[model samples]
Target: MEIKEYFHDSCVYFLNLEHRDDVLKKMSENVQEQSLVKASFGRAILDREKEFPTGLDTDHIGVALPHTDKEHVITPFIAVGVLEHPVSFQLMGGGNVEIEVDIVFMLGVTDPSAQVEVLQQLMEMIQNEELSNKLESAQTKGEVISSLQHFTSLMS
Candidate 1:
């Protein structure tokens, strides 16, 4: 499925100023409003942070995905959070250093099997330096939606 099909334009956060806990909390709140994710989404984000951290420090840009198990998800959807102000998230690969992430692709995978495809597509998009830079600087909902659509189509 296309990222646009799963991530509606309405769900894109164009002016997110909060960082850390507030960011994650707001994301959880957003999903909680819909049937996509329940209260457990918050728990999962925190739990995932402790286990497999999603922060990425790439040559072009930095990004993060606070993903969780399917059990915490209700409906499948992605929360494309564009932080107007960068947030600090611990890097996953190694090092104790944290990166300032302007973009967050929070995955709500209701089906466990869908996680692999979603991650693979997301990774492909992340690997594109130009695309990653564009996404990092995206300031409008339409821009974010179009970028996600383009990346997903390319991957597919």
Candidate 2:
């Protein structure tokens, strides 16, 4: 599946939140408003994060890929959050290790098997320093979407 298809303009956000939970809650609410996920999505995602942290300490910046199981998703979507200030999140698979995250990609995938592929693509994208810089410095949602689309196009 094309990963870029999951991105929606309405799902892109410029957030100035102070904490990880707050950021997740806000992004989850937005996707819920768009009817992409069920109401249980927010709680499920939060719980999942606690169990399996998604924070990545990338080469260029700190990023987080928070997602839940397929059951909470009504439709697959990727919600991007560009934070004005860094929010601390527990490192992925690094117990008690925390990283300050600058960008967040909240994924809602309905297909269980496809989740791994989507995550792999996202992992590749996040590793690109240029794209990470563009996303972090993006002045508007359009810029963020444009960067992601361009990157995904190259992958195709």
Candidate 3:
């Protein structure tokens, strides 16, 4: 149930790289913050986002979950990138209108069934204001990972 179980430490980052393509750029930034296995990861999520759109507009805030094929992932991971600036993404729940996404949870799931579980866990985390606040304010990789671990553990 823990993100680390699926997402390795190498795959977790703060997203500090640059690129011409926004999606690739973001993923590169996240790679800089999180992993070396990022170019493919970013490309995958960008492609998926273009097709399926992972942006979600909840009662509390708007967020995006960009992910790609499991094969690109060395281990299952949910790389979280907190953008210093929000980006526009289409919402999954309603209209075509976009939302400013401050939090990006990139999921790397090999088993399709695990996708739902990850989504559910992410949804629960987003619903709690305290948890969301913690994630938004997390200044370090350890802080982000620990917070996610604490919440997921308690939920299970």
Candidate 4:
């Protein structure tokens, strides 16, 4: 299963939101409305994120990987959101620690096993400060996808 198959130029977006819920809502709506996920997708993601945050804080960037069950997904895809201002999110596995997130990688994985591999790729991405910095600074959707091309194929 190629991970790049899950991304589309239409899935990339730039958002300006104040709260964590807004960020999740924006991305969830995009993925759902794009016909990638089911109608229940947004609600599932929001509920899941509240219980188990997927926030990650790296050296050059902070990101959240919010997702829910496979049942809520129709076609597996990813929605990229670059926030205008950093939004607060509870760090993944870091109790009581919050990070100001600049990006959000809203994952829509329909296959249960594929979830691990996707998250692995994302975790590997955060380690590369250069790549994350480029993505964070990217002004357009194409630029963001270009920055991620090293680790992900734009054409699947």
Query: Which candidate ranks first by lDDT, i.e. highest?
Result: 2
Please give, for residues 25-111, the per-residue lDDT of candidate 2 as tens digits: 999999998889999999999999999999999977999999999999998989999999999999999999999999999999989
The sequence of per-residue lDDT tens digits that candidate 1 reaches over residues 1-156 is 555577877678755665666787788888888767878789779777867778887787778888888888888888888887788888886667788877888888877777898787777788899787787788788887888788777767
Whole-model alpha-carbon lDDT for candidate 4? 0.85
TM-score of each: 0.89, 0.98, 0.79, 0.93
Off by over 4 Å in 2: none
**Of the candidates shown, which would achieve the greatest TM-score relative to the real structure?**
2
**Position 133, candidate 1: lDDT:** 77
Residue 96, model 1, lDDT:
72
CA lDDT of each prediction against the hidden true structure? 0.79, 0.95, 0.67, 0.85
Candidates, ranked, lDDT: 2, 4, 1, 3
Candidate 3, which ten residues in sequence have the lowest lDDT sum?
15-24
Model 3 lDDT at residue 85: 61
**Model 4 lDDT, residue 44, Cα:** 92
